[model samples]
Target: MASLTVQFTLRRYVARAYWTAVVMVSVFGTMAADVLHIGLGVPFAVSTPAFLSVPAAVFMLWYPSERTLSIHSIQTRRREAFRWAAALATFALGTAAGDLTATVG
Candidate 1:
């Protein structure tokens, strides 16, 4: 029997999709807080979770299925652009959902 070990090296650039996702989530979260405070004329006592985040997660799944979800694997500019766009869309959706919650709930 022979023993084999496989090691993976960290690439200079990782998918970084997680970073974008975090940014988007943070933006939406902040928006939700601000909207609830000012728009509702109330303190941060009650604020709903970002529903838009759902779409963001979905976008990640669909995009990668359509293409690929690797940091070093993304070899095309179009894929990169799509990634950014998905992040932006998720952020925007989160903002809208937050506002809607403030208005309705």
Candidate 2:
């Protein structure tokens, strides 16, 4: 959060700040999915599609409000917020799917 604030404010950390946020989101997302499967004893078959619905839901809301899901159209604060939400949801989806493949035997 700090990096994202400093990033858009300082005008010099655009890519680095965004990348930092993405990496952090990805790591935490993986941990979250892992907790559902390993910690809570959920199965990948159940969690993968469940996580998939999140991003799909995000897109459903985002598209109706913004009329377009293209990154090129993200020129407003609302759009940016939606973009981040989608990113977070998709990363969580990726984590679940990756684990499904890796652990399947």
User: Residue-wise lDDT of candidate 2 within 66-101, one digit each (tens)?
Assistant: 999999877777877788778777887898998899
Q: Estimate each model's TM-score.
A: 0.39, 0.84
Q: Lowest summed-lDDT stretch of 10 residues in model 2?
A: 4-13
Highest lDDT scorer: 2
Best-fitting candidate, scored by TM-score: 2
- Model 1: which residue pairs collide? 15-71
Candidate 1 structure, TM-score to reference: 0.39
**Model 2: residue 60 alpha-carbon error in angstroms:** 0.4
RMSD of each candidate relative to the true structure: 11.9, 2.2
